[model samples]
Target chain A: MTTLRRVTLDVLKPHEPSMLAFTERVAEVESVDGVTASLIELDQEVQNVKITAEGAGLDYDAIEAAVDGLGGTIHSIDQVAYGEHVVEERRTLQDG
Target chain B: MTTLRRVTLDVLKPHEPSMLAFTERVAEVESVDGVTASLIELDQEVQNVKITAEGAGLDYDAIEAAVDGLGGTIHSIDQVAYGEHVVEERRTLQDG
Candidate 1:
């Protein structure tokens, strides 16, 4: 079975549980190596944010449970990577 | 009981499942009224994204399951709103 290495999600949430508190909560999830949260947009009651997480063996379910327990919803699953040793794929532009 | 109306998250994902494909998959979740995805940043192997979803009685579990099924992970719960008739909270600057 392929192990998940990294995952990205788009999430929308209410305003009370401040983003700082929320980030701290998610970062504590088991197997999550690191987390970075950036605010994309905000209105009167909600804020749109991008959640990026990376780790050796990411636990999708644990991460989900943490977000749910905190009263947040995932809008979209933006990206994913899996394998024994997942590495960021990068390539330089080749001029024709 | 409080009902969730909107949620925002920060996510990091791999490059294969194009953001468009990812968004399309997320939009299909039950109780999700609408989905908007915007690209935040990209590297050789991964892309960071912000996903916003709005709806009545939003299902955090379904959303999370769908994203995980599609190979994404929730990095952080950025914001959350709950209660009846959830309304965007906006306040004008009052003169001091």
Candidate 2:
């Protein structure tokens, strides 16, 4: 079985829930062992954050629903890793 | 003692040694468990690569020496994680 080990997403969320609270909510999702959300930018209305979630076999839909429950919108799924372990993305020359 | 878990470096090296050979050489270092090298750029003279080495307790000086032995210069140490486990770098809003 192809297991999702990690995922990184760009998300936009309201300021009502603090970053700590938001991270805790995501970490509570089943299959998720850990979650980290870093504030990228923020305005009066919303904040942009980069979120990374890791697990043995992450369920994307469940994670999405959890983010939705917090009134957050996922801008993009930046990176994903599947299989026996989480493989980090290597920046190629084209990234420059 | 704080153990070095992982290190990502920008390296420049001659085309003589293939990426596979370079990675293998680095992986052979005393404390490194695994090493991955991705081609970032290449010219007639040299190839620029992004190298990530991981282990329970990585020795940076030894890794540097291995690269040096291969006629590779460590352009920059982009990232380093020292702890119980490897921590991914979280991109923040200020990154933009």
Candidate 3:
């Protein structure tokens, strides 16, 4: 079977649910191995955030439901990695 | 008033329509300034992707609609930046 190894997203959300909690909630989804959230913008009413998830055989629908349950709106998908095997970050020779 | 300046997302999509066309469709939404997309993984069935959008007072709903129209499902929101001014990447002291 094909697996969704990694996914990154842009989210608009309310401040009531802390980023940590949100991240944790997403982490709880089946097949998700880890989650990371970074604050991009914050004002009085809302927060703009980036969330990245990595795992094996990720269930995209379940992840969506979790985020929606937290009152967050997903704006866009920034990146995705998927296949029968795990994903590895690619770097150029300049980095070495 | 509040503004949604930037957003990053993980998306699940079909290969048809091409990434370029999909990106252009999203860019046409009202209030969007720019968009960027990176390929995370590609298999015979689907493509997992990351999409980033930056703009002033972004209309999140409009963006969502456009993405949906393209037969894409947003998997997660990865990051966000918003406020009166533009978003600038913040670096740590170690970087300097």
Which one is best on lDDT? 2
> Going through the candidates in order, what is the number of backbone clashes in each?
30, 1, 29
Candidate 2, CAPRI quality class derived from DockQ: incorrect
Task: Report per-candidate TM-score of chain A alone.
Answer: 0.85, 0.94, 0.86
C-alpha RMSD over true interface residues, each candidate: 13.7, 8.7, 12.4
TM-score of each: 0.47, 0.53, 0.50
User: What are the runs in model 2 whose C-alpha is more than 4 Å off?
Assistant: A1-87, A90-95
Candidate 2 residue lDDT tens string, A1-96: 345667778899999788888889999999999998888999999999999888987887899999999999987565555444554655433356
Best-matching candidate per DockQ:
3
What iRMS does model 1 reach? 13.7
Best candidate, TM-score-wise?
A: 2
lDDT tens digits, residues B15-44, model 3?
Answer: 988999999999999889999999999899
Winner of 1 and 3 under DockQ: 3
True contacts kept of each: 0.00, 0.00, 0.09
Report the alpha-carbon TM-score of model 2 versus the true structure.
Answer: 0.53
After TM-score superposition, the amount by which residue A32's alpha carbon in candidate 3 deviates from its true location, in angstroms, is: 33
* Candidates arranged by TM-score, highest first: 2, 3, 1
- RMSD, every candidate, angstroms: 19.9, 12.2, 16.3
Q: Per-residue lDDT for A9 in model 3?
A: 77
In CAPRI terms, model 3 is classed as incorrect
* Model 2 iRMSD vs. native: 8.7
